[model samples]
Target: MSSTTQKCADMLCHRNGVLKCSRCKGADPETFYCSPECQKSDWRWHKKFCGKQAYVFDVELLGSSNPKITRKVAVPSWYTFKQFHFVLQYIFGPWQNCHLHTFSFLKELGNQRIRSDFSIRKEILLELCHEGDVEYVSQNWFDEREVKLSDVYEEDGRLRSKIMVNGNFAPLLYEYDFGDGWEHKITFVKSELARAARPLVKEAVGCGPVEDSGGIQGWNKVKEAFAATQPTTEQLERRQWAREVSGLEERYNPLAEPDVIVMNYEGRWENHEEGYREDERRRTAF
Candidate 1:
């Protein structure tokens, strides 16, 4: 049912509700509540199946090491690709949205993998394209602003027909920071409703890499240097380099827990909307 017309799932209340169940926000037959009190009151019955089914994903940073970085997140199916990008940034290092990114779809053909002809990219990339690049942009790219997660995956969490290869769905690839080549493999883990309208992190492992600390190889070097017990001269220099580059007064720790709360707050779509509107106003003023 459309979000606007949905009624409170509390059988007795049946009020036209706006708040979705924290654990079942994106379920097919979505559950809602008019108030937290109603939701709490209904918990006894609802808890049985609240988060049993929904859109869940495992996002792993492709080249992380020392401990390997990964996160399990529950995302609403209606989220746009742009929103997904923000979610990734939040869960990872709370990455500074300083670079361009793309979402690629790949199909398996026998033993070889082929990237789908088209990719979804940030809207700023399209805006930056010159007139001469219009055809190329149109043929190879889709604006992330226009595509929802549901457009790529079915309500049942299966890949849609057109994009499926040999009746199997492929994991989606997200590449951020073209210069650093920070690639993340996004694998659909299960069909389960998320806890909120915003993506929720269910699990997190290892620490996110330092921005501009080079790429995977550079990050690995930093880890090796810091992990050393009896440091060699070169390793000491490397540690010094990492500190300077990362703006850390002390050695970088690869195992520390990320500041997830701050990340989620900064990455909220509402904050993005405010920034986007301000940018639009500036552009129009000029």
Candidate 2:
């Protein structure tokens, strides 16, 4: 007789006969073998549930008249910003998440479901979604959100939205044939900040970043697309916030950025609390 429910040994999971493995698409493939030892032994299959090493970085960088300007950035609480996009891709897919970035994506990722702390790391949170399929539902703002219980497939990314802007959180898909394989992508309009300026920065002085746009602006966005830069955090204030977010701080390199592992508290929305203020050192042009 087929059992209605089974405990999964791998992924520490529980399975209803109706639901199958997302990674294997296996139907009740004896997930639970009735022992903790059985589950530990079955981790090879569970390992597939995780994606490629999350730190896919593109080394292209932006040029600045001032050398002190951030070559690296860090987002608060997270070491690897790829964790965000990885979850989005796993929950949705690369193309769907690309469609999610068309607007003021600068502030759209801040939703409760988006930041839930299921595990010490955000990537592990994806494990919860791996157990089921995700569906997309439109918010009144016209943007889409995920519903794992309702939809068969869901994939996308969103920024922190303070004011709701109505638009479809829809997927705009793209494809590139690599001969050996077809690479898919999602297309969307990208916008740049128009702050009154200092010197105009280029993605690279002579050689442009991989993106054809070829300006400081292009570098910022392109590095991410190329998987070069990940959002990083530099704790402007350590006693107040750095201690809260950092796991460990070891020296990065000598000569230039000696304090390579700077504090990153990007999501903090508090008053600036710097005790000592020194005029920032000016950088001679490189």
* Whole-model lDDT, model 1: 0.64
Backbone clashes in model 1, listed as residue pairs: 22-195, 53-192, 53-193, 54-191, 54-192, 54-193
Find the candidate with the highest lDDT and give its number. Answer: 1
lDDT of 2 by residue, 192-246 (tens): 2211111111111112122122334432443333232343332222212312222
The backbone clash count of each candidate, in order, is 6, 30
lDDT score, candidate 1, position 10: 77
Error of 1 at 152 (Å): 1.2
Per-prediction TM-score: 0.63, 0.19
What's the true lDDT of residue 217 in model 1? 89
Evaluated at residue 119, the lDDT of candidate 2 is: 28
